[model samples]
Target: MNWVRGDSLGHGTFATVNIVVPANGSTFFPSPAAVKSSLSHNAGLLENEKEILSRLGSSPHIINCLGHDHTIENGVEFYNVFLEQAAGGSLADQVKKHGGSLPESFVRRCTRSIVEGLRHIHEHGFVHCDVKLQNVLVFDNGKVKIADFGLAKEKGEKHGKCECRGTPLFMSPESVNDNEYEPPADIWALGCAVVEMATGKPAWDIRDGSSIWSLLVRIGVGEELPKIPEDLSEEGKDFLGKCFVKDPTKRWSAEMLLKHPFIKVDSISFDKVHEPLSPPSPSTHFDFPHWASTVTASLPSSPYSDEWPGWSCTPESRLRRLVTDKRPENWSELDGWMRVR
Candidate 1:
């Protein structure tokens, strides 16, 4: 597929993301899709991400990887992977836009989507080593999808001695101490993400000038768990309780959480109670400045061409249509609640 790279969306330590337009006007690919590129010598992680997404197949709750290719620019070789663009930006951007905390209903909706994505990843025998708000991309329709699988690994994949992946702020207890990365670790990180969404703060109280060592010790060396948001609903708190369990064996799996009361609530009505003050606006244009990358880097603003064709149907809309068409005869057991089976 021939494409031209556009504006710099964001850059992490290993990869740079930019909006790319399909030069051939291929209907097979989304126009202005995101392309993550890295120097050829440093493309292993990008290649792994593409392979992982390919293995996982297409899911509405997971970012779609269209394809990958090599390109040369300025006498340098680069590897690039095309991904579905989430115009609403990352969940972190939403939190920041809302002044730190998100409405509980919105948090519930996003959490449900993340869990669904994690369920798919875990059932396929893979672990998302880094599950955080920054890694969850929000769509214009308010649906969320799990993104950034660069740190993902096969279930039970072993790490080298004293090695650990993922940001320290979101690491599971076992991962911090024993170098273990598994499905349970993802759940733990999900708990942290929930806390961030509900409270607009890191799960741990890392005051100014705190060292990473201290944070690791707090997570792995003690019985302390991240504080749950007091303002969160009872079901929400209980749901997080299941995630914050220190014992991986006892932690709730994604399937189990899907049955939890927190996720089973009537999102349509519940959403009305605490509607977002500033819901993300639907747009076909790319808005990349607010999308935070895995690593922090100062980025320059660039304009995207408006002449590109729009998608016939977005992934979120397609998924909604599919659910409406294939919904079980008895999917809802009560008003405002969905049955899990």
Candidate 2:
């Protein structure tokens, strides 16, 4: 709690964030921190954020809450919370620096990290009512962590109109309709964040200056989902499909998504160790159209059972499938693309 305030990081409607250094050689924390504070009259929001961060405990993906304190200036009291300072700044800052969009590879890596953080939050029985790129912070090591918990609530907590939370641009369908939302709502916001990362634009086009009410109407009642980037790979499209499901119960959970094909990283060997090489003096290349019919001409359309044949009904089983698949050479020879694991 003993600290000296430094430069301002940013200012919000309710609070101002400033850099903090330990006071009088205090060793409470070695690293610098960002302190969020407001005058006594407007301290409730910042105080609530401090409480939520404390309850969530420490995780590499969640911002660390070192402590809190109070100070008096001109006879006015101010309350503050000491938060881990993200050296690389907010995710929004990164997008801006990258010219309003990031490469697909960078988007995938960042999305994986955010999903891991969301999984931890949901497992801990809390909902991050606000999940947007602005609230995600990037560290020096390129690691991203979720921050700004002033609107977070426990699972299944009813949200009345007076307590409606989060930014309109990222609000889920349920949130837009009735202000009733849950952990799945956060997933919807996460999907929006991914689109922003890929296109360097808000998930929905807001530049035309449309009314908020009209935008929410489209989200809550429209048949179509936000447009997915055409340039994305099939696996990437499928990953987003899982996020944009209209039914919250059907939407993919963070735990399930951690096993998805798009985000999983691994190395696969494409060459067969013992394959005999033929002379390559001629210009003719290998064509499998006529040769492929030999193996599949007589096979049933649906060869396998309803469930995946080799994978058992377990989370770990699904996650380990690609890593354990031994036919890497065959996979490489096919038309489909392969990612690093």
Candidate 3:
């Protein structure tokens, strides 16, 4: 399908995501699609993502990849992959918009979607090495789909002993210590994501000046587990308990988690209880001390190899503030947008 790219939705370390519309004024293609593009020379990750998405096939819980192709503009060749646009942005954005955390019911709904997506990925012999809130997109129809396959790998894929592929905050113990990236690692990350959704904070208590070495030690060295949120339901905590087991083998798989009481509600029951009468107000008692603010830490080169340069510890609230501050007044307007080529 011929399409035209609009303004960029966002850009990450490797590629830019732009809103795309079907060209020739046709409605045959999915409305409000997105195109992720990168310079041909640096498009390996994007290409890999497309290939992985193709292998995963169609699942309601997984983002749909429409197509992929190359285009040349201004004498520069670019690689682009078309995707279904999630109108509700990302789960991280949702957590921030809801004032740092989500209600337990909402968290359950989102967790179920993520588990289904992960189950599908794992059943196909793949592991989503990065399964965090930022990679889970929310749709307008009150659904969530797992996105971003840039770090995905087939089950049992080997890597350099010192290589770490996911965000440090969400890395599983085995991943941090043994360089293992498998389905269990994804489950660990999912648990971390669930904690973020329920508590409005990272699973591990990472202070402003925490060093990468210390964080890595906390995750990899001991029998430590991310603290379960006190306010969560007992079943919710139990579900997380299954996910946060220090032993990856004991950690619950996506298939098992789907049946856990925390997220086992049927669709009909979920729809009835999912919609809140009013938006949940932010809890004023929850303290936001200065130590919880944004932090940037440099990864020391000695302990781990130089493969990883550094990482940032930006909170979702800070990211939400940035987006609100920079968003255009006419941001909702989608018509008469510029074309990609």
What is the clash count for each candidate, in the order shown? 0, 3, 0
What's model 2's TM-score?
0.76
Best by lDDT: 3
Candidate 3 matches the true fold with a TM-score of 0.81
Per-residue accuracy of model 1 over 1-341 as CA lDDT, tens digit each: 66777666665444667777666555756754888877788677788889999999989899999888888765768898988887767787777777777888788878888999999999999998878877788765667899888778999777565554666678888887787889999999999999988887878876644555677789998799999988999999999999999999999999999889888746423333233433322221123122121221111121121211111212343345334554211211112211111
Off by over 4 Å in 3: 26-28, 267-269, 272-341
- For all candidates in order, the CA lDDT equals 0.71, 0.65, 0.73
Residues 1-341, candidate 3, lDDT per residue (tens digit)? 56777766765434677888788876755887888877788677688789999999999999999889898855768899989887777777777777889988889988998999999999999998877777788777788899978778899888766565777778889887888889999999999999989988989886655665688899999777899999999999999999999889988899999889889866313453333222211111123221211122223322222222112222342344334553211223234565555
Window of ten residues with lowest summed lDDT in model 1: 296-305
Which residue pairs clash in candidate 1? none
- Better structure of 2 and 3 per lDDT: 3
True-structure Cα RMSD, model 2:
22.2
Q: What's the lDDT for candidate 3? A: 0.73
RMSD of each: 15.2, 22.2, 7.8
Q: Point out the higher-scoring one by lDDT: 1 or 3.
A: 3
Candidate 2 residue 14 Cα shift, in angstroms, is 1.3
Worst 10 residues of 3 by lDDT: 276-285
